[model samples]
Target: MDGTLIVGVDGSGAALRALDWAADEAVRGGFPLRIVHASGWEWYEGHEPSFGINRDVVRAQA
Candidate 1:
């Protein structure tokens, strides 16, 4: 959307590879890059809130 390059990624190897590919494509197209991810199992069981979590923090931790 909005001519942006959006990509989804999980913790798996293939997902990471796809993310890298998307980043390259975004750079080549001169488009902004966006990452979109969804929780697969945490909705059923959770600890506290992720209210203040930041994207960079999550990425570094991952």
Candidate 2:
């Protein structure tokens, strides 16, 4: 298939587990894996956003 296998992770164990399963499925089907992670903690909790994340790497690859 030309479609990708997408998984969303939010720094949770459950999400990570889902990612692992999705990865396996993607490999078995010869599809690409896309990890999607989003956070709004900075806006709600006044916390600073995370830096040095892999956003640049993902964007470059995309």
TM-scores of the candidates in the order shown: 0.63, 0.62
Model 2 score (lDDT): 0.77
For residues 1-62, what per-residue lDDT tens digits would candidate 1 score against the true structure? 35999888866788889999999999888989989875567643654457655659666745
Q: Which stretches of candidate 2 lie over 4 Å from their true place?
A: 42-62
Model 2 lDDT per residue over 25-51, tens place: 999999999999855455336533456
Q: For all candidates, what are the clash counts?
A: 0, 0
Candidate 1, position 3, lDDT: 95
Clashing pairs in 1: none
